[model samples]
Target: MSQTVNALEVKASPASNQTGYRSFELGSFAFSRDEYFAKVTWHVGGQKLSHVMSADAFLRAMMRDVAWGFFYGWVNFDPVIGTRNLYGKVELYAGAYHPAYKEKGLDLTETFDSREIMATFKAILDDWTNEGFDPFAAPDETDTTWVGKKNGNNRLAIERQRQACKRMPGLAGDAELRTDKNGYPVNRAFADVSQEEPEVHAEPGFEDEVHAFSLFAYLSRSDVTWNPSVSSVLERSLCCPTTEEYILPIKHGNDRVEWFIQLSDQIEWEIEDKQTGAPRAKVIMKAGDVAAMPADIRHQGYSKKRSMLLVWENATPGLPELYESGKLKPNPVEF
Candidate 1:
C-alpha cells in the first residue's frame, strides 16, 4: 500500500501552556515540551497513551532525523517512540514494534508525508534547544544545561552539515581539510591517533584525480558518536566513517544491506528481526573484523570504549521497493 498522501496531516498549535515551546499535532499524536522533557500524547481505543523523552535526547535524535532526511528505516528515539521512513512518507509510531507494547496491543502508528513530520520536528528542535547546549555533541564534550526556556539559538551547532566529499579531502576541487579553527579538534580519548595526512603519488596529469586522506586521522577529531559522516561518495555507494562511543541512540532498521568494517576498538551489536523484534544474533566485532547487517533486521550497537567504524551503504534510489518486492535479497550474501 502506498503511504504517500497529497495533503499534510500535521497541525501546528501555539505555545503549549505558556512555556513558549510550540506543541505539534501529527494526526492523532500530540507533541509538547517543557523545560526538561518532550512529551507525546495520543488516544487509542478510548485510552490516552503518553510517551516522554529527555529534552536533550529528543533534540539529539530529531536533529539526526531532520539531517539524514529521516534516514533509511526506523529511527527509534527511544525503544517506545520513533519514526520509520518510507522515502516520500514517514511512519510516526509509539510502541508499534516494541515487544512490551506490541504484546499488549497498545501500539499506535500514523503515516504522514515526509515533509509534514520533517517540518514539525525541525520546529520542535528549534524551540526546545537552548543557546549553550549542543545536541550533536557527546555528553562529556557539551554542557547539561538543556533545562529552562529557550534563551538563544544554537544554529551553528545543530545545523552543522555532515562532511560529504565528491572526491577526497585536501584535493583542490573536493572537501577542505579539517583544522583546529574549524572546531574539529582531536577527541581526548583519541589523542594517540595520528594527525598525518596521506601522500598520493599520481601520474603527471592525475594530481586532482588521485588523492587520499587518512580515515583514522579524519575520524579521530569527530565530536559526535554514532553519527556517520560521508567521507567519500562514488555513485550510489557511500563510505561513511564515524567515531563510536557508548550506545547507539537508535535501533536502526535497515531497508538495505549495510556493511560495517571495524577500524578500531570493538562494538557489540544487538541484532533483532526487523518486523517482530525477536532475537536474531549477538555480534561482537573487534578491530579489523567486518560484518553485514541484513536489510531484513534491525540492529543497535554498543561500544564500551571509543572506537572508529566504517559504514558502507548503497544509497541507490528505489532500493527499498526492490527489497520489499523480493526483486532483491536483503542479505548481501545468500550462502
Candidate 2:
C-alpha cells in the first residue's frame, strides 16, 4: 500500500464562457459548465469524447464524491461518466465501463492523486452551484436554479458535515439528537411520523449505558435524500439509515454484500453485473422487505416517495481482497 503523496492543488481555471464560473482539468478529463449543462470531455485514441449532464445532476454527484471521500469503489455519476476510488488515488473516466464505449475501445481513464481530484471537484461544485439550490437535497425540495450564471454560493448546504455517530444519537458525548432548533425540522413527506423518543428503564449502573431514541423521528428530520448516515456502529458492523426519493445518483459497485432493510414506503432496484453492466434483475421492495445487494453486481434504486432504508454493512478490513481472491462468495448466502 506504499504510495507517494503529491502536493495538493485545485486543477481549475476561469472558463471563458461564464463570469465567475470555472472549468476544471483532472488528469485526462476536463469539466466545463454552461447555463444548463456540465460537460466532461476526454480524448480516446484520436477523437475527443464528451458527455453532458444537467448542471444539478453533475453537482449532486460531485457533492457525494467529495463528501464520501470518493466512496468505496466506483461512483458512476451516470452510466458513462464517473470516478473509481483507488483509495490513495482516483480513476477519472469517461465510458470506461459502458458497453458501447468498451466494445469500440473508445473508453478513457486516467488516474490522479485522490487529493488533487477532490480539490478540483470541490472547486467545480462551489463555482457552479448557485444560491437557493442544494445539491444534497431531494430534487423536489430544491429548485431548478442551477441553470444560469452563478448567482451566489450555497456553502452551508454543500459543506454540511455528513452525520456519523460514535455510538448512537442522544448518548452522552456522542452525536446530538436531531431537533427543530438544530435546523432539522421534520420533512413534509414524513409529517405523520411519530416524534416520540423511546423510554428506557435502566437499573442501577445501567442508567447512562441504556438509551433509546425514535429512529423514525430522527429520520423525519433528514434534510438530504439518498445520503446514508451512520446511525450505529459496533466494531466492523455499521447500521446506516437513509431517506430516499427519486433516483440514486450513482450506480454503486459493491466490493462486498450490502444488506438493505426497507423501513418504510417502497423502492425498486435495478441490478446489473458488476463487470459487464448486463441486466441482472429488477427488485421491488416494500416496507419491512429486506434484500441483499451482492458483491458481484452493481445496483441502483428508484424511490417513488420518500422512503427509509437501512443499509447494513460489514466493514472488516481486507474484505474486498477476500472477495476478489475467491476466498469468499459474492453473496451472503448460497441459496
Off by over 4 Å in 1: 1-13, 16-20, 99-105, 148-151
lDDT of every predicted structure (CA atoms): 0.83, 0.86
Among all candidates shown, the one with the greatest TM-score: 2
Which model scores highest in lDDT? Answer: 2
Candidate 1 local lDDT, 79-163, one digit each (tens): 7888999988999999998888788888999998888888777766776788888877777767777887656677777777777
Model 2 residue runs over 4 Å out of place are: 1-7, 15-19
Tens-digit lDDT track of model 2 for 1-335: 11222455666675555456777777778888888899999888889999999888889888988888887778888889888887788988888889999999999989988888877777778778999999888888897889788788898888888898988888998888899998999998999999988889999999889999999999999999878888998987999899999988888888788899999999999999877789999999999999999888888999989999998888787887888888999988975
